[model samples]
Target: MNLALLFEDDFVSADRAVLTGRRLAHLNSVLKVSEGDLVPVGLVNGDIGTGLVVGLSDTEVVLQVELSEPPPSPLPLTLVLAMPRPKMFRRVLQTCASLGVKDIWLINAYKVEKSFWQTPWLSEENLRENKVLGLEQARDTLMPRVHIRKLFKPFVEDELPALLHNTRALVAHPGTDTPCPTHINEPATLCIGPEGGFTAYEVDKLVEAGCEAVHLGRRILRVETAVPVLVSRLFDACN
Candidate 1:
C-alpha cells in the first residue's frame, strides 16, 4: 500500500494511529520499516501526510502522525456503469478510485447477469475494502461514493436527468458516430455499459435523459479498461 489509510477507529489519540492486519503485514513484508522511520499515511476522507513510526511489532505498528495537507482534488465526474462481471468488479472500483472518481453509479444492463449483483464484492464492507486499496495505491484520502441502482429504466427516467444538470453527460458506445471529447474542463457524467454494450432502448433512455452517445474508437474495451481510459481522456489531470 502506498499510503497507509487510517480510519477513525485506528486513532488512539489526536496524533497517533495504530495499524494491524493487512497494513501491518504490508509494512513488515513489503516495506520492512523500523522504529523511527517515516512512512506515508492519510486519514480516511481527511488529509495526506507522514507518519513517524514510534513502535513496531509482529502484531501491530504505532505511528505519530501529522495530517496537514489536503487530499488531491477529486474529479468533478460522475461515472455511471452497467454492473460488470463479478470477477472484475473489484478491480473496476479500484480503478475508479485511483483515477479520482468521486461519484459512481452502478446500474443493471440487459447483458449484465443478475448473479453479478450477488457477489460478495458488492457488499458494503467489501466495497469499502477495495476502494481503500485503490485510494492507498493513488496516495489519496478522499473516499469515493458508490450508488447502486438495480433498475436501469427507473434510474434513467426518474433520476439521471437531475444528475446530469450543468454537466457534460456522455454515454460511451462503441459504434456511435460522435467521438468522445478530450480533456474537458466542466463537470461530467459518463455512462459505460456492459461488455456487450447497452441495449438500444437503454441508450435511447439515457439520450432522452441528456447524455450524448459517443464512441471510443472501434475497439471494444472491457469495463475495467474503459474506465481509466475515459477518465484520463476526459480530464486534464486524471489523478
Candidate 2:
C-alpha cells in the first residue's frame, strides 16, 4: 500500500489515529517502519497528508496525522460497464479507483453470466476493502461509488438517459465504425461490454439511450484491459 487510508474508526482524536490488520502488517513487514518514522496517510473522502508514528507494537500502530493537501481530482467520466468475470472484477475496481473514476455502473449484458454477480467480491464489505486497496495504490482518499444494475433493459431505458445528461455518451463496441474519441476534455459516459462483447440488441438499447457506438480498433480487449485503455484514451489527464 502506498498510503495508509484511515477511516473514521481509525481516529482516536482529532490528530491521532490507529492502524491494525492489513495496514499494521504492511507497516511491520513491507515498510519496516518504527516509532518516529513518518508515513504517507490520508483520511477516506478527505485530505492527503503524512502521519508520524508515535507509538508502535505488534498489535497496533499509533499515528499523529496532519492532513492539508487535497486528494487527486476525480475524473469527469461515468463508467457504465457490463459485469466482468469474478476473477477480474476486483482488479477492475482497483484500477478504476486508481485512475480517479469516481462514478461506476456495473450492469448486466446478454453475455454476462448470472454467476458473476453472485461473487463474494460484490458484497458491501468486500467492495469497500477492494476500493481501499485502489485508493491506497493511487495515494488518493476519495472513494469511488459503485452502482449495480442487474437488469439491462430497465437500466438503459429508465436510468441511463439521466446519466447521459450534459455528458458525451459512448459505447465501446468491437466492430463499430467510429473510433473511440481521444483526449476529450468534456465529461463522458462510457459503456463497455462483457468478455464476448454486448449482444446486438443490447447495443441497440444503449445507443438508443444516447450513447454513440465506438470501437478501439479491430482488437478485442478484455473488460479489465479495456477499462484503463479507454479511460486513458478519453482523458488527456490520465496520460
Candidate 3:
C-alpha cells in the first residue's frame, strides 16, 4: 500500500495527533511504519505534506505534521458522457476522477437505456466512494462534481452553449469525417455517446450547440477504451 492514502475524515492541525482504527492498522501492519519515520499525508480538499511519527502504540500512532503545499491543480476538462451500463458507469466515473477531470455531466441519449438512470452507482454516496478511490490512486484531494441531465434537447439547447463558452469542445463519433485531433492546448469539454453511439438527431443537436464531431479511427472502440485513449491523445496533442 502507498504511504499516502486517504483515510477517514481525520482533522489535521499543526499539533501532534493520533491515528487509530483502520488507518493505524494500515500503518502498523501494511505499511509497517515506525517512530521517527516520515509519512505522506494530506487533508481532503486541502494541502499535501509530511507527517513525522512521534509516538506509536498498539492502539494508535501519533504524527506531527506540517502542511506545506496546496493540492494539485485540476485538469481543465469537463466530460459529458451518455450514461453507460451500471458497472461501466462506475468505472468511467473513477477514470474521470483519476484523470483529474473537475466536472462530469452524465447525459441522456437515444441509445441509453431508461433503467440506467436508476443505477445504484448514481446515488451520491456511491458516486463519492468511486471518485475517492480514484483520488486516492492519483494522490489527489479534490473531488469532481457530477451532474445528471435526463433530457437531451433541453440540455443541449439551453445549457450547452454556456458550458462551452470559452472551452474547446469535442464530440467523439466513430465515422465522422473529421478525425479526433491528437492534441489540444486549450481547456476542453468532451462529449462521448453510449455503446451504440448517438442518434443522428442527437449529433445534430450537439453540433448545433457548438460541439464538433470528432473521430478516433476507423475501428470502433468500446466506451471504456475510447475515453482514456482520447484523453491521452488529447494530452499529447496539447503538450
Candidate 4:
C-alpha cells in the first residue's frame, strides 16, 4: 500500500488514529518503521497528508495525522461496463479507482455469464476492500461509486439517457466506423462490453440511448486492458 487509508473507526481523536491488521503488518514488515518515522496517510473520502508514528508495537501502531492537501481531481467520466470474470473484475475495479474514475456502472451484457455476478468479490465487504486497495495505490482518498445493473435492457432504456445528460457518450465497439476520440476535455460516458463484445441488439439499445459507437482499432483487448487505454485516450488528465 502506498498510502495508509484510515477510516473513521481508525481515529481515536481528531488528530490521532490507530493502525492494525494489514496496515500494521505493512508497517512492521514492509516499512520497518520506528516510532518517530512519518508515513503517508489519507482519511477515507477526505484529505491527503502524513502520519507520524508516535506509538508502535507488534499488534498496532498509533499515528498522529495532519491532513491538509486535497486528493487528485476525479475524472469526469462515467464508465458503463459489462460485468467481467470475477478474478479480472477485482483488478478492473482497482484500476478504475487508481485512474481516478469516480463513477462506475457494471451492467450485464449477453456474453456475460450469470455466474460472474455470484462471485464473492461483488459482496459489499469485498467490493470496499478492493476499492480501498486501488485508492491506496493511487494515494487518493475519494471513494468511487459502483452501480450494478443486472437487467441490461431496463438500464439502457430507463436510466442511461439521464446519465448521458451534458456528457459525450460513446460505446467502444470493434469494427465501428468512428475512431475513439483522444484527449477530450469534455465529460464522457463510455460503455464497454464483455469479452466477446456486446450482442448486436444490446449495442443498438445503447446507441439508441445516445452513445456513438466508436472503435479502438482492430486489436481485441481484455476488459481489464481496454478500460485503462480507453480512459487514457478519452481524458487528458488520465494521460
Candidate 5:
C-alpha cells in the first residue's frame, strides 16, 4: 500500500480523515505508523498528498491531510479485452490500473469461457476493491472504468467503432504479420484475447471494427503478462 486511498466517506471534515478496515490493519501492521508520523495519502479520483497521523487505535486511525498535487496523468489508452480466466482477471485488471489505463472494455470472445464472467470479481464491489488495490499500489487515485460486454458481435458491430474514434486501434493476435508498435504515446485502443487467444472469426470482427491486428513476436503471452507488456510498449507511463 504505497498510498492510503481516501474516499469521500473517509473524511470527517475538510482536513480530517479516518481509516479503518483493511487500511487500518495495514497501518497498524505493515506501516506501523503512530501519532505525529507522516503517511502517504490520496483521495480517490482526486489529488495525491500526505497525512499527519493525529490519532490511532485498534479500530481506526485518524489523520489531518493536505492534498495539493494532482494524481498521475492517466494513460491515453483504452483496453478492449477478452474475458480472461477467473484467476487471471484480477491480476490483469490491476495491471491495467497500475499502468494508468483509465478505459477498459471486457468483451466476450470465442475462446473465452462463459464461466469466466460468472466470477465474483466482476461484481461492482469486488471490481472497486481490486481497482483500489491497484491504485494504492501505483500511488495513483484516479479510478479506471470497466465496461462489460458479454455479446461479442453486438459490441464490435454496434459500439466499438465509436470507441475507436480518434484513436490508434490495434488488436494483439499471435502470428499476425504486424508486430505491436512501440512508444506511440498517443490515445490508442488495444484489444487482447483470452488464454488461447481470439479465434480467427473473432479477430476478423475486431479488425473490421477499425482495429489493426498486431502480434508480440512469436511468443504467446498470457493475458496477465501481455497486458502490462503491451501497455508499456505502447505508451510512456504517467508521463
Candidate 6:
C-alpha cells in the first residue's frame, strides 16, 4: 500500500496508465488520491518514479507516469531456507522482498512438516502474488526470484555447486562453534532451517557443501523472526 503499483498493460501511452479493479478502488477510497497528488509509483519490473494524477473515478484512475530510474539494488545475498509452515511463508516472502534480498531458495529439512509442503501457498501463482505484494510494499520493482528444492540431498550435492560459485556461504544453526559474524561485506549465501532447526546431519551436509556453520546466539528463534534478524544483521554488517 506504500506505492500505487501498476503494470505496463495498464499503460495507454507514455504519459498515461489506467488503473482499474481493486487497485483503482484502493486509490479512490482507501488512499483517497486526488488530481495532482504526485503519487509514488513504479512499473511492475521497471523503475521507481512519480505519477502525476490527472484523472480519477470509482472504477478507474489515470496517472501520467514517468519511469526512468531503476530501483535501489538488492542486497548481494542469497537466502537458502528450509521451508517453514505454510502460514509463515507469505510473511517471510514479503519480508525478504521488502528487505531487498536478491534470491531465495526453499529447501527441505528433516524437521519440516510434511503437510506444510501441501499448502496452496506453494502454488506458483500464489507465490508470485506474495512476491508482488512485497515489491509493492517496498515501492520497488525487480521481483525476487524463488526456487524450490523438495529434496535436500540433491540440492546440496548436485545443484548447489553452481549456485555457490561466487558466494561465501554460511549455515545458521544454534549449536555451532562460532557465532554469526557481525558484518560481512562480500556476497553471501545464508542457510536457515525450520522451527526446530536443522538436524546435525543436515547441517553437516551444508557445511560439507562449503557453508560455514554459524549461529545467532544461545537463544532459539522461529523461522519468521530468524530471517529478518539474520538478514538485517548481514545488511548492517555489509554497510
Which residue pairs collide, candidate 6?
A: none
TM-score, prediction 3: 0.86
Q: Per-residue lDDT of 170-200 in model 2, one digit per residue for the tens?
A: 9999998999999998999999999999999
Q: Write the per-residue lDDT of candidate 1 for residues 139-174, one digit (tens) a residue.
A: 999999999999998999999999999999999998
For residues 1-239, could you state the per-residue lDDT of candidate 6 as single tens digits? 77766777889997799888867777777878999888888887778888888998777888999877888688889999999999999999988888888699999999988898899999988987888788778877888989988999999999886777788788999988988876677888999999999999999999888999999889999899999899888776223
- RMSD of every candidate to native, in Å, equals 0.8, 0.8, 2.8, 0.8, 0.8, 1.7
Off by over 4 Å in 3: 1-9, 12-29, 54-62, 236-239
Error of 5 at 150 (Å): 0.3
Instruction: Give me the displacement of residue 221 in model 5, in angstroms.
Output: 0.7
For each candidate, the alpha-carbon lDDT, in order, equals 0.94, 0.95, 0.82, 0.95, 0.93, 0.86
For residues 34-125, what per-residue lDDT tens digits would candidate 3 score against the true structure?
89998877666777777789889998788887678876678788899999989898888877777778799999999999999999999998
TM-score for each model? 0.98, 0.99, 0.86, 0.98, 0.98, 0.94
Error of 2 at 70 (Å): 0.2
lDDT of 4 by residue, 73-102 (tens): 999999999999998999999999999999
Candidate 1: regions farther than 4 A off: none
Q: What's the C-alpha lDDT at position 1 in model 1?
A: 90
Clashing residue pairs found in predicted model 2: none
